[model samples]
Target: MLPDALPSRWYPIFSSAQLRRAPTVVERLGERLVLWRDAAGRAHAALDRCPHRGVSFKTATVNQAGELVCPYHGFTFSPKGPCAHAPVLGRDAKPPAMSLDIRNVTEAHGLIWAFTGAVEADTPPPPWFEGLGDDLRRCADIAEEWPVHHVQLTQSMLDIYHVGVLHRRTAPGSGQVITDFTMTTTEDEVHTEGRLGHEGAKGMPFVARLRLPGLVHLDVGFGLHVLVGVTPIDAKRSWVWARYEARLTPLPQLDGVIAWLGAKYDFTVLQHMEDLPLLKSIEPAVPEPGVDRLIAPDAGAAAYLRLYRRALSGRMEVAQ
Candidate 1:
C-alpha cells in the first residue's frame, strides 16, 4: 500500500550533474532502478534486473552505442528498455519486446526526474516553482539521505511552530511564536500567514506547494527559494534533494559570489546541520494523528497533512 501510493507521479532521482560516464543505481518506491544517459545526454530509468538470469544492472555497463549491456548474457537494451541485440542471435535478428522494463524519465531545473508508473504522451509535466525563470541562477544543490519516512521530513518543513524552538540558535529571529496564525489549504497546496511577535509587526507568509509522490517548495524570503524533493528509497529510508536559488541582481560582478556564499552558509549551518540531527531523533517514523496533542501553533503542520491525504485520495480515485 505504501509503495502503490508513490506511483503515477514523477520523483527526482538524481541531479543532472550526478549522471556522468557510468550508470547509477537508485532505490525508489521499494524498487531498485538503474539510471543511465544516452549519447545525447537523455536520461532513462528501468528495473535493475536483467531479463535473462536476473543479473542486476549494477554489474552492467553502458556500451559505446549508448545501450546498457548485461555482463552475464551480452544482451543490449535501448533507452526505452527493449532489447535490441543479443550475441547468441548474431547481428541481424531483432530481440523480442518487453526485454527490459523501462520507466519514464525527464530532466528539468538541473534535476533528473523518473516516473514510477505508466506514462502516456498526455501525462502531466512535473511541478515547477511558480516564480522561478531563466533569469535566476542556482547557487547550491544539497543531497542527503535521511533515516526516517519521507512523510516525517516533509511535515517538519510545514511545522511553523518548530522554527523558534528547534532552530533558535541556527536560525535566530525567525520562527518566533506566531500571532494571529491562519492556515489555508487547496487540493495540493497550503498557505499560512502570521506575525512573529505582537500585532502590527511585519507579516511572515508561508506558502508550501506539494505534488503527489513527494515534492515540495518552501520560500525562504529575500528572493531566495528552496526546493525539497524526497525519494523513498524503501519503507524506512528516503533520499532528499534540496536546491537553493536566487534571482540575479543588477550587479553581475558581486551577485554570483554573494549568492553562492549566502546559500552555502545558511544551508550548511542554518538548515542541514540544525534540522538533520533533530529530525533523526524522532522515533516511530511516521506518527499517526492524535497520537500527540496539538496546540494552535501547529496549524501549518496540520494543514499540510490534510492536503497530503487529499492527494492520496485523488490518486486512488484515478485508479478506480
Candidate 2:
C-alpha cells in the first residue's frame, strides 16, 4: 500500500485532451474525482460523490453556467464546489448547506494536474522540466495505465541499467554496461548523470532528473528528450503520462514529425514490447527499503527510494 500521507505535490492525473465539455471521472491518489472545464476552458476538480444524495458525479452534466448538475436529483454545484441549485426547491430557492470536496486542479504540459496538499495557497506551480519549455507543443504526448504501483514504474525509469538488456530488441546497441554513474539529491529532486560503456563500443553519456513524487526527465542525446510522470490511481495501478520530443533537424516542421514517430516507436514499441512485461512481474507492487539488494549501478533508484521515504515520513520539507 502507498503511504497515507503522500508528499504534498502536484500529481498529473489525465491527459488534457481527455477532459472536454463533459464531467470526466478519474481515480487518483485513491480518491474518485470529477474533472470539468468552465466556459473559459479552465479546468476544475471535485470529489466524485455529490454530498446531498451520494450520487456519483460521473453521471452528471455541466450546465451552460459551468455548474455540475447531478443526474440523480438535479442538485447543482459550481466549479468551487458550493451548491448552486436544488431543483427539489423553487428554481431561485436558496440551497442548503451542501458542497462537494473541491480539489485544486490546473492544466500544464498537455496534462491535468491535481494538487494533493491541504492548503492550495501553500502549493507551488506544477513542476516541469525547464529544458522542455513552458509547453509540449512540439512533442508527442501519450498516456497509459500500468497495472503496477506508481513507485515501481517511477523507479524503473530511474534504473537506466535495464536499457541495454530490457530494451535490446527495440533499442539496439543500448545494452552497454554502466560506468561513471553519479547521482545528486536535494530536498525534493534527484539528478543523475552517467556514461554507458561496452568493449569496442564508443561511450554514450546520459542524463536523468526526478522531481519529488513522480516526475522524470531523461535526455538520451541526439536531440531527443523523454519526460514521464507516474500518478498513482490506487495501490495496484498507476497512470503513466509520457512526452517524447525529437529535434533532430533545424526545421520545426521536421522536428514535429520526428517527435511523433519517436513517440510511437519508443512508447508503443519499446515500452509496451519490453518494459511492460518485466515491470508487471515485480513483487510486492510497492517497493520497501532493504527488500532488494543494491549495487553501484542502482544509485539512481536508491536515491529516489530514500527521498520517497523521507517525504512519506513528513521529514522532507518542500519550500513554500
Candidate 3:
C-alpha cells in the first residue's frame, strides 16, 4: 500500500488527447477512476464503479444528454456525480438518494489534472512552468508506466549526479563530476543549479526545479525544456508523463521539427537506453529516509525528500 499520508495536491494523470468521447478507465493514486468527455468536450472524473450495483464503470457509456449510463442497468449519472435518472424508477420518478464518487478534475497544459486533496471553494488551479506559454510547441508527449514507486522515480529525477555516470554511454564526453552545485528550498519548491564538470573543459550549466507533488522542470539550455509529472498508479507502480517542448527558431511553423529532433536524440536515448534499467534495479522500490547515505551531490534530492515528508504530514501548504 502507498503511504497513508500522501500530500493533498493536484496530479496530472492522463494526457488530454487520450480521453475522448468514450469513457476510459485508469488506475491512479491507488484508485480506479473513470474519465470521460461530454458533448462539449469537457472532461469529468469519478470512481470507476456504479453506485447502485457496484459494477465497474469501465463498461459504461455516455448518453446523448452528456450523462454517464451504466451498462448493467439504465441508471444515469451527471458529470458532477449526482444520480440523474433511473430507468427502473420511470422517467419522471425522482432519482434515489445516491451519487457517484465524484473526483475534482480540470484540463490544462495538454493534460488532465485530478485533485487528490479535499475539494474546497479555494482550490487553486494546477501548477505549471512559468514560460510554457502558447509560443512554445510540444514536440513529444510520452507516457510510460514504471514498476518502481513514484518516490524513487522522482528522487532519481532530482539526482543530477547520476546523469554523467548512468548515461555515460548514451551521452559520451559528459563527465561524471558535478561542481558548483547549489540548491534552494522554498515552501513548496526546490530549485537546483549546477555544472557538470569535464576534463580540460569548462563545466556545462543546468537548472532543475521541482514543484510539490511531483512536477519537474529541467532546463539544459539550447531552448529545450522538459516537463515531467510523476504520478503513482499504486504503491509499486508509477506513470511518468514527459512533455518535450522547444522554441528553437523565430519561425513557429518549425517548432515541431525542432522539438521532435531534441526529444528523439536527448529524451528517448537517455531515458530508455540508460535511466530505466538503473531505476528498476532500486531496492525496496520505495525510498526511506534513513536507509541510504546521501552526499553533497544529492543536496537537491535530499531537500526534496524533506519537503515531501513535510507535505505528507500536512505540515505545509502546497503552493499552486
Candidate number with the higher lDDT (1 or 2): 2
- Residue 305, candidate 1: how far off, in angstroms? 1.7
Angstrom error at residue 38, model 2:
1.1
lDDT (Cα, 0-100) at 15 in candidate 3: 92
Instruction: Put down candidate 2 lDDT per residue, 136-176, tens digits, no spaces.
Output: 45678888888878888998898886778777767777756
**Best prediction by lDDT:** 2
- Model 1 C-alpha lDDT versus the unseen true structure: 0.71
Model 1 segments more than 4 A misplaced:
1-4, 94-98, 133-138, 197-209, 252-256, 313-320
Candidates' TM-scores? 0.85, 0.93, 0.91
Model 2, CA-based lDDT: 0.82
Each prediction's Cα RMSD? 3.0, 2.8, 3.0
> What would the per-residue lDDT of candidate 1 be over residues 13-100, giving only the tens digit for each residue?
7888888746888777677888888888788888899987788888788887789998888899988778888899999886675478
Which digits, one per residue and each the tens of the lDDT, describe model 3 over residues 88-141? 988887576789999889999889999877778898788787776334354577
Q: Which ten residues in a row have the lowest lDDT in candidate 3?
A: 1-10
Cα-based lDDT for every prediction: 0.71, 0.82, 0.81
In model 3, where do residues sit more than 4 Å from their true spots? 1-5, 133-138, 264-268, 315-320
